[model samples]
Target chain A: MNPLWDREILMLLGGVVGLLALGTTVGLVLDRRVTSDAGRAVVVNLKARVRSWWVMTAAFAAALATGGVGSVILFGLLSFIALREFITLTPTRRADHRTLFWAFFVFVPIQYILVYREWYGLFAIFIPVYAFLFVPVRSALAGDTEDFLARTAKIQWGLMIAVYCVSHAPALLMLQIPGYDGEGAKLLLYLVIVVQLSDVLQYVFGKTLGRRRILPKVSPNKTWEGTLGGIGTATLIGALLWWATPFSPWAAAAIALLINLAGFAGGVCLSAIKRDLGVKDFGTLIEGHGGVLDRIDSLCFAAPLFFHVVRYFYT
Target chain B: MSLETLAAGALTALTRLVTGVRARWPDEAPSTSPRVYFANHSSHLDTLVIWASLPATLRARTRPVAASDYWDRPGLRRWLALRVLRALPVDRSDGCGKREALRRLIEALDQGDSLILFPEGTRGDGAAIGELRSGLYHVARERPEAALVPVFLENLSRILPKGEFLPVPLIGRVTFGAPIRLGTDETRQAFLQRARAALIDLRNR
Candidate 1:
């Protein structure tokens, strides 16, 4: 059976649509009820985010419907945009131009191509090993030693987070788990749904009941209540969807917990970077979610760990 | 659509894809009225990126003031400049050419077409905005009715800086500040200083 139309995958997508519909309805109610200027502002932002979520879900579903290749290309393009946003915020001198050109044009395509080919060994090591060495060498050859280490490290970090980490989501398709043969798409969807749901739940919880700040300096919006509530709910959801994955209910819950923690770390780490860069959001690409980087920061941290866990245990 | 329109559309799309060029109008939404969009010159892509960031309605009437010596070569470059971009070629060679270029720029403004002008007159090192040339002052002086809009093109130099051809795919920001106009008794030097300051202001923001 085609994984695209598999019962579990369709059921998962239906759940997402239902969740979005509920969100839209709730947003409409809030918009109508919230009369104060500050409350109205929050409602407006909520509506924009919900609108973007609908578009994002449709795009994600379309990509999944096309099978592995579509997801690969879609993630590839997302990586490209995320990397562009990452580098745009990082200060790179004219000396690093060639290295950046190589990063964007050569290394990005080659990495995605390796993923498409399902050559996991190379896909896993290409950016971390080869591109890692190449970036500094190319920058050194450019002869601008000023901030050389910092510059090279930044470019490498950008590629790692924006390309490498994000690529792991699609690389999930390459995992050859026993009995999960054509269902790699479901695992990919599972990872995304859990990670993003944690984020959304955190935001919802934080807005309604959050009192104490988790990391106020790094990310003011995060709170302990929100984090715990979000992780607990999303993990329960993930566990309930164990039929979509190779893992058992308990195993799925454990993995969901791990993914949620990693995603929270990723969000905080990226928010710290933004604070250091002295900007609110990375870029204004997404309507209310900030840039592609902003939307996928959690995925960047969650994907690699989730992929490796599934690969190691299930495969 | 004509081949010119098709090429223009492709170029704009390609520019957006490659650079993810984002436009931010801080003061007012983009209007269709005649205006002079002046920006810091850095990479060769600056003009196209700014032109592409404008709304299609404004883009159709907006012509970039490009150097003929560079873009007037007989081939693809010329075709892209004249046919696709519909650039207003400015001769930067001699005094007579300078006068003719100013006349042509004013003529384009008189015809009610918006213009994208790089007032530095040449590409900078991308680190800082170079001193403003008098051409922007002169053009604004002649066409007082047209808005003198200061635009700041950021990170384009890093994407495709001076002397490099292969462009790295980095997001480029095009910021359009509140429009300024030449005061009735403002001196050319003062107006030029103010214009340069306006671009610097956008950069800092």
Candidate 2:
């Protein structure tokens, strides 16, 4: 058997499958009960969301099954698509063409390559330190100073969110825990499950019991009831899965709460970018999920935080 | 499949992966009937993107109207133009050559093959639409039965601009608008302006 599919990994996969089956049943029941036109529209969207979740979960599982290199490639491709969607909306002048090319083709691949090779020293500072200075220099060489600082800043910011942050999820596989050898996949899975579960549960709770809005201007759907309920439930679930991780039950719950808060911040920040661009979604790639960026925005925030926290305490 | 067909498939797939082409038809679904797809020209990839955006059935019968001076080179370019794209190369050096090119386009339309035409005659900076040449008007007058569809290709020039050899990976949107035809008793200038306006209107849609 591949080391990636140890006993603990199998149990995690089985749990995800069981949850998906339950979601399918709820979607079917809701599809039959909704009668009004508005209610039917919401039900149809909910069903689409559930259907896409199954496909995404299968793809993720297949990637993890192939080992660390497979996961690195998958996240690398997602980062590419997400960065494309991000820059497409944020307008840049002709002078920034070559600079944008370096960001997409050069820096992105180098960053992921470092992660795959487990070069901890360079992978941590490659984007933030080197690419940060290289972007403006390349744009300055183009000799068009129309919006020099703004354009360079936009490209660098996009690289940080789309490539740098997202790569940390697969980078988790490079962690060297004392006893829990070759089981970083489980920890990555735990972070993803808790973060994504919080998102889905927030939507469910908001629709059912949400009365007050959290941020009326930024995201109208986020409610206090949804946030507290979803994060509270996901933290408890994470604590129960502490046996798979190199953490105690209380430590697991504390880390889950922190991850949930960071994920929430990620969603709101990306949402503000959308509102600034005056568009509803980033791109129409996914059926119910807006784009690759929209689907993985929460992961963008949670992954880096989770990676550092685990590296500090456990490793 | 033939070698040419295999090469075309590979080229289409590469174009889609690099550009992430998102094609939308705001007016109606794409039809298989004979039509002229006239779009704004800004980069070399404009023709390929438009050709790749077509449905496979329509792509089989659609030929692009390309400039012979550029694509008529000796080796690989000529092979791609003649075999894979099946482009009808037009000479733009002289008046006699111009008439000959129009004759060939009319012949292709009569044979029930659609043509992808760039009426600007040359590449632009992609900021604004250039003045459309008279070839689109003449083609419309000759083949009145074929529909004239306006296609707007956004962000293609940014992908592979005029002088850049390397293509930046970006999303390109192809929007097809409602078809128009030359009006009865309309002069050449009036009909050309109307056709240009139709193509411009699709930019926002």
Candidate 3:
């Protein structure tokens, strides 16, 4: 755990670099080929997204290099920022101020600290059971009953999505799978790679072959054709990367497919929230990809289920 | 970078991290000319956010007019305000003469550095902005050539509110509106109203 520079880690980083090179090549080709205004805009955004991917990949690689401690801190910051973005969109009043303070300063840190300490019993139910009850009662004490139900629910939901679900990705470090040494980091890496790859494929397939919308009301860019193509490619790739995880090839495919579907649902649900808020993106952090929340919406949606799946079967 | 710039850079980073700021400039863009960037104040963070939100080049030239009572204390707070932030402290307490405060602000503008002012004089209750004091009008009137830019800061009060030590990270939007000038015959009431309206107009945009 102190120094983890294994061949498997190197291979994963190398594969990511290879993908970056390929992505750059495709970007160059798109730049020369696309003539229409819409095509040029898409290409520009694609290039920006790719550029952001390089930064994100580099950050992720650095985090993985530090082993479990690094990954936990990384995801903890993500939860902090993601929760901020979520709460920023929701309406809260003066009574919610101290409540929000406790949410950020107290609850968020304690939740991640439990993960860092490898307390599985507390990590699993801390947010859902304890914080769930604590938040409303805390707000109720403030005595501002105006929108009490809505305010409490919004804070709870913010903690659930931003803190609970997202933290599960890092909590992968705590999984004690039988016959699988200390390669839980690899599993986290695999899950991230699969989800991200699926997202890219879905976008690629949607832009090229997409015609029928999956649910135009929920998400316009998403389509039946793109979803299938993304799942297909991602599952195939996930199966190939089974050596990195503690799963069989076919099992990897099933898990990748499961993550992709869950990620897709997550993306759609987040998009609905964005529409309700009447904004196109969550924040202007990433050049063209939007905020950290926007980039990890799929991961947040998929992490809990994926963690539980691997924990239940492999561990 | 020197120690000051390095500390300022760190401060700016922390401010941006806490306030997910999205800065929008006027179509005419901010000029290097001596100008007063005024806004509605709510939290202590208002000065930091406005200062941090400026473009890098302009940031060096713009000094926020902070309340001397809060920023001019001993040790770290004063060091941060005077050295790192380069704030122009105007004694906000009642005992300190307004004439002395006005003299220092005018002196700053005369030295060719732009100033950020909260003409409301003090922080409000986070409602609609209270009446703007005549400090800004006097500045505008005194330096007739200087542009008066109305800057609107939203959600900053929520990010770091009154009496709160730890700041909750919240997205704050800064809208810098067009530059206004003091009309030749304009009264103080009319001038402040026009400037206030311009700043509030930024909220919708």
Q: RMSDs, each prediction?
A: 1.7, 1.5, 2.4
Clashes (backbone N, CA, C under 3 Å), per candidate, total: 0, 0, 0
- The TM-score that candidate 2 achieves is 0.97
Residue B92 lDDT (model 3): 73
Error of 3 at B59 (Å): 3.0
Docking class of 2: medium
Residue-level lDDT of model 3, residues B4-29, one tens digit each, is 99999999888887787878896567
Candidate 2 — which residues are off by over 4 angstroms? none
* Cα-based RMSD of candidate 3: 2.4
Q: Which residues of candidate 3, in runs, are more than 4 Å off?
A: A1-9, B1-10, B72-79, B82-86, B91-96
Local error of candidate 3 at residue B13 (angstroms): 3.7
Clash pairs (backbone) in predicted model 3: none
RMSD of 1: 1.7
- List TM-scores for all candidates, in order: 0.96, 0.97, 0.93
Error of 3 at B114 (Å): 1.2
TM-score of 1: 0.96
Cα DockQ of the candidate 2 complex: 0.76
Report the C-alpha displacement of residue A287, candidate 1, in angstroms.
1.8
Interface CA RMSD of each prediction in angstroms = 0.6, 0.7, 1.0
Interface RMSD after interface superposition, model 3: 1.0
Q: What is the lDDT of residue A166 in candidate 3?
A: 96
